[model samples]
Target: MPRSLAARIVQDPSDGFRHLPHLHTQAPDLHVSFDVLGGGRIRARMAGPAVPALRGTEHKADLGARPDEVHGASARLCARWKERFVDFQPVDDQGRALRDRQRPFATVADLTAAPEHELRAVVADLVRGGASLLFDTLLRGDDVQTAVFRSYLRSALSQQGLRIRFDSDLHLPWPMLCVAADPSAGKASLDTLFARFLGHRHQIEHTGDAYAWIGTPRTTQSQPVVSLNHDVRVGRTTKADAVAKVLADGTLCTVRTTYEELIRDFEQPHLDEQLMYFWCHGEFVGNAPEPPVLAIRLTDGTPFDGHTVRELRADYRHSSFRPLVLLNACYAGLAGASADRSFLSRMLIEHGAQGVLGPLIAMPQAFAAEYALEFITRYLRADANAGRITHDLARHFAAQYRNPLAFTYGLHGGMDAQLERANGGEA
Candidate 1:
């Protein structure tokens, strides 16, 4: 798939000899494209495949309605999460658990664990309410919007093991958004409620327009090349060590210790890495009045944000430079507005990265480490695409260990991202 993909692009950056391995960028089974209209309104058009009723025809549906002020629905949800969990009940400096609170902490195993149930309920409410915000705010004039979205999701329920992607300008959490049925579809049972979350039910991907392109491959690679860019101070942490071990075992590992070093490396014309993993801190930095821009730190604490990448990789348009990026930092995965400056997700994607996966909030390092190990291990050794792998992980953590941190990680494009053989097939 990687080599064949290289054949499609008009420009080639490699020397006449080497090939660059491509990430999976296949089309989805169903896609919904959302565009922001003025006044928090959003317009949607379902592209490619049609709803079940309209499938198998030569018709292409452009479903649109008067959009509403969903302007910062995703932003609001993120804020709510931090306020509920972070400010009120926050993680310790090590990201262990809620800061020492007198309210009595409890794990899932404790029969009288109010905190566990409370957290679960909070997550559920956030998801469903987010769904309501997205679903309701998406098409607001009449029953038209509801009908269109519900019909789209209902048809989706029938398709097994395929991803359903959402594209938009809003920075909303696609995975956390809930799915609703029309009053007529009947009330869902408790056992079947897991399907309510778009992330759990489907291999969901939400990205900006032009989120992907054909990724190329390097024929010379014995094992994929991986780079670990982390803060200098976090070297001794379990999370950092766990990730380093994974990279060491599966691929050729290169380490970047500081923000200056990462930017300096990006300045180089060629970045041969197939996977770029950043185990650092993501911050929202800015002046007093201006909204804080998202930036990252690498022990040295210098701000490394998207602006640097956009400036450095602006010329990557024809480079065939595609690497699956994992930002295990806070606020890196929270969806953002369409304004052009300092969007970590958009900056990387617009510059030819295949996929960008990261946490939507300040994730505790404990769960983040486990999630990264599972994701990276599968990505390196299994044939599953990133989206399917994400879905499976969500289920795995929720069921096996009773952890919900998996859903906090968001995927931008690269749903079809899986290892590919030189012959253009699944590796």
Candidate 2:
């Protein structure tokens, strides 16, 4: 990590920490409640320094009952997004482009040279579509929830370190929900309002857990793990090289070739890695009616998903180390509209992954590669907190490529997660 691009951009002379309030801290915390009322009903509630009144709202949405409708709406939304915003040739989870790759424009050169208006158009379209889906469909008729959330924002006094812990089953894209949007004001995305909205299965009793560990693990010096499944088709080899270059030395102890091997390696003694990175393709398997399972590629080019990962995770359930997993897989960050814990991201969390950074939908290999390089490079060079690193990488890529797909990647863990490598970690 000889002061790479991300390092040079983010590192400072005084301290490695950049001290962006939004990225560095999780302050002015708000408690959000979304309880299951049985029969596809949900009760949304809010409380904090912002919501002293302690109010809540209820809504009806049964993913199991209306699976087709929910799935169809999601598909339509994603399709429209792709049609409007995708500029570069995007490969599916198998690294195959839906259309011919040799077209008017496909490479990174074409992407960088694309006009600013084109980028702005993509952002504008994304904001509009995302806002419509969130408000008109997801939060429909839930005026109290919106009003309470707005009040929470007002009470924060524009502080950027707002952390709203969502304890609900409605896997809503809380990060994308717009607080305020004015095209003339250049405020298109809601990411600027808060660092992140923490989510989980149950309530968070203490604020300290949101940033730092509430209880110490038995092992503190355990090295992190990097599992880069081999995939020459989509240029994953280069991506893996980038990660290995950064996490060199003994900072990364277990660099496995396959998912099974990675799990086996972790089973060995003195191999409790605190952090793990997965670089491969991921997709949703299974048809409608039954929720889709997240399928990810292995070193042998075989794909495995949430069910397989969950089985392996059980092997480490009693282990003290709760690793932070970085998933470069497409749809690795997506959560369906249900309480079901089958999605890859949620499954990892349930299986003791401290948190996960992944994409909410399918991602372009080029974009995913660049984002990974930037994130790992910054993390190694600046030692910035993981949440901050995610936001920074997405923001930097969005600005550089004028691609709103950067917003697809998000931090799904404690807002205060900081991943520090062993003494000699280099990117």
Query: What is the per-residue lDDT of model 1 for residues 289-392, given as tens digits with 9 covering 90 to 100?
Result: 66667898887888888788889988765464667888888878876544332287677877777788988876666667778888888888755878888999
TM-score of each: 0.78, 0.70
> Listing every candidate in turn, what is its Cα RMSD in Å to the true structure after a full C-alpha superposition?
7.3, 11.4
Q: Could you say which candidate leads in TM-score?
A: 1
The per-residue C-alpha lDDT of model 1 at residue 386 equals 83
Off by over 4 Å in 1: 1-25, 37-41, 48-50, 53-68, 85-116, 143-150, 154-160, 181-194, 211-220, 235-238, 287-291, 337-342, 420-427
lDDT of 1 at 406: 70
lDDT of 2 by residue, 1-427 (tens): 4764643456547443443324434542566554555665645455566445533532223222233344345455555555655544446689887574532122341255554444554555555555555445544454555554544534442344445565554454545444333444234333331222221111121111222322234344445454444443555434556665665544655556676775576454344555667777776677778866777786576666666666665565545656667788876766444434236666666655667777766666666777777776665454666666665554555455544565566566644555544464422
Pick out the ten consecutive residues of candidate 1 with the lowest summed lDDT: 102-111
TM-score of decoy 2: 0.70
